[model samples]
Target: MSNQVCAPALAIRRCCSDDVHHMLPLMRQLRYPTTPSVLKERLTMLEGHEQLCSLVAEVDGVVVGTIFLKQHQTHDMMKPVTSITALVVDEKHRGTGIGKRLLLEAETWGKERGSSQMFVSVAGDNNITSKSFYEYSGFTCTGYRLSKPLA
Candidate 1:
């Protein structure tokens, strides 16, 4: 007895709701809060806004990875920047270059949008593996966080 299978060639493209269902699970795997209600709100936001951007990675018409980018402007009035809020790839596809493609695509998208910088906020604890990935992908840690008490 044996199992047989075929791997589909991966392709990357702009996202649509059809890809959202698959993207949600990958989001959850990364500890991103996800529920029908939350996902619905996100999908609605994506559909209703031009400022929101997401890219999907597909294999044989199935979404296997995603990167979510939100455009933002500084209060000082400077060139727009993009915040990379989430990026995930199916566990089975990890390390196969799909995640890398999604990130590079995000950077390219930022460039196209005239973003002065791309930013991401991540937990402070060191996860060497994760840190290595970010560094390998050309992100640097700036080591700054500001907090102030609200009266």
Candidate 2:
């Protein structure tokens, strides 16, 4: 006999202001540290933006993952592109397909908005796990993302 524990049902939906408390820790896990108030403000701002799509994955009413996508048109691009600004799955649920589901939802959201391509920026060069996951999900590294801080 095979004995395998089943994972709880996952629910992915547009993030709302009330989700700040639940999403804060996930954001911290992704290296974005902020207070609940600040996170609430950010979530409110995202809610007011027409080009932004923020989604959260919930399991048994607890937020376990989130993805933030933005749609924009560049000077060089003929069609709008959807950029994945943030994606994080709780450490305990990392390998259970939450991230992938969130990503797929983001893609659907983008496509519904007429976006022709999807893009994501990985912060560090050595983040092999993230790179591998994206690659496995059909994303290819296109170019380097360089940043310079302003004084």
Candidate 3:
């Protein structure tokens, strides 16, 4: 007889203000540290925008993954582009397809919003895993993202 346990059901939905507490740890994993109040305020601001889509993945009702997608148009681009600003899955759920599901959902959201392309920026040359993941998901190395800190 097989002894494998069934995986919990995953629910993907819009993130609510109450999800801030659960999202803090996930944000920390992505290297963005902030207090609950700060995170909540940021989330609220994002929610007020129609071009932003913030989603959360919950397993057995516990939030375990998140993705924030934004749609924008630039002077050089003819059509709008959807940018994935943040994507993070819980450490324990890293290899469980949660991140991919979040990405797929983001793509759907973008397509429905008339976006012609999807974009994501991966910082740090050492983050090979993130780069590989995005590449595997059909993203190519288009160009470098240059930045300089301003005081």
- Model 2: per-residue lDDT, tens digit, 1-151? 8899886889999999999889988988887879999999989988868899799999988999999999999999888999999899999999998999999999999899889999998876437899899999999999877999998
**Colliding residue pairs in candidate 1:** none
Candidate 1, position 20, lDDT: 56
Name model 1 segments beyond 4 Å from true: 1-7, 124-126, 144-151
Model 3 TM-score, 2 decimals: 0.92
Q: What would the per-residue lDDT of candidate 1 be over residues 1-151, giving only the tens digit for each residue?
A: 7797877788888876655577778877787778866776776678646568878899888888888899899986589888987777888888898989998898988888788888876653435666677888898988855667998
True-vs-predicted CA distance for residue 13, candidate 1, Å = 1.9
Which has the higher TM-score value, candidate number 1 or candidate number 2? 2
Clash list (residue pairs), candidate 3: none
Per-prediction TM-score: 0.80, 0.92, 0.92
What overall lDDT, based on C-alpha atoms, would model 2 receive against the true structure?
Answer: 0.90
lDDT tens string, model 3, 25-63? 998888897999999998887775889879999999999
Query: Model 2 segments beyond 4 Å from truth?
Result: 1-7
RMSD of each: 3.9, 2.6, 2.1
Error of 1 at 122 (Å): 2.0
Q: Relative to the unseen true structure, what is the C-alpha lDDT of residue 63 in candidate 2, on a scale of 0 to 100?
A: 96
Q: Kindly report which residue pairs in candidate 2 clash with one another.
A: none
Candidate 2 residue 103 Cα shift, in angstroms, is: 0.7
